[model samples]
Target: MTYALVRPARLDLNSYARATGLHPEAVRRLVALGLLEPVRDARGELCFSPAQVAVAARIQRLHHGLSINYAAIGLVIDLLDRIEELEADLRRLSERH
Candidate 1:
């Protein structure tokens, strides 16, 4: 089987902030808090995945809409990730049976 490789577009800090409608400092804080993961490109500048824009947008809604603190937001995100993992596992197990 041939595998198809798909690469996500990477966004620089300013572009990411613009796309997310968040301030640069807010993105920096998210990176500092380990909520966002940015990797260095060939130029050694920090860049984020396009997919992370959606994640940041979700966090923005949770922070502004629900007034949730960053720590709680982290926990909430983690729980949601766990739920998705469990659901995927359930689906796989059902398919195997």
Candidate 2:
């Protein structure tokens, strides 16, 4: 058996903000809210994965298009987390056969 290690490209805060059209503060807020987990590079500065950058773009779109506030987004995220927890419980119960 062979194992493959994959590394995602790391993006700095400013570049990511420019690339995604999101304010760096907004991304920082998400980080503060536990929505994003930026990685620390060799230089000890915070950076984000490409996938996280992609999600930031999506979140920016949702906010810009729908004018959603952080509170609303937080609520939706909470509901989604509950739904995921319920689904996991359902799967566990079904596995009791």
Candidate 3:
């Protein structure tokens, strides 16, 4: 049997936002909303990933293009997260089926 691993390098919030044309505060808000995850170092400063920036950019698009409010955004993000988790679980189950 073979295993698969997916590992991405860490990025700082400023760098991530700069790469994706997003504001660090926007990404920070998303992290507070649980829509994005940011790691902290020994000093408790937030660090982001490139992929996290991408996700934040997409979220920004959704809000801008669809006029999504913060409350609605939070709900949608939560639902989408659950959907993704469920899909991953389903894929794992299918692999053993």
Candidate 4:
């Protein structure tokens, strides 16, 4: 099995909230809503992957720019995840051919 060697730098929840300008409650809500996937650190604090910042940013845009509600955001995020998976599958199949 192949593995990705490049592990992204991790950011603590506080830093993530600060960098994204999102309140801690918002971050917690995102995590609780299954929008953000966070890992626990050694100290048992919430930590997020760097990639999650981009996802959060997109969600922020949808929420603020388009005034999208959480339910709609969930749907959009699900659709986007499916699209990414499909695109990756297509790329792999094309490479095989």
Highest TM-score scorer:
1
Top candidate, metric lDDT? 1
Local lDDT at 95 for model 4: 100
Q: Ten residues in a row with the worst lDDT in model 3?
A: 2-11
lDDT of 3 by residue, 1-97 (tens): 9665875577787887787677888777777778787888668888776677667776887788989975588788778889999999999999999
For model 4, residues 1-97, the per-residue Cα lDDT tens digits are: 9898986689998899988889988999999988889999889999998888998999988888989997689898788889999999999999999
Model 1 Cα shift for residue 3 (angstroms): 14
Candidate 1 lDDT tens digits, 1-97: 8775976689999999999998999899999888999998889877999999998988988988999998789998999899999999999999999
After superposition, the stretches of candidate 3 with alpha carbons farther than 4 Å from their true spots are 1-8, 81-97
User: What TM-score fits each model?
Assistant: 0.80, 0.62, 0.64, 0.73
How much lDDT does each candidate structure score?
Answer: 0.91, 0.77, 0.78, 0.89
Q: What is the lDDT of candidate 4?
A: 0.89
User: Which ten-residue region of model 2 has the weakest summed lDDT?
Assistant: 54-63
Model 4 alpha-carbon miss at residue 70, Å: 1.7
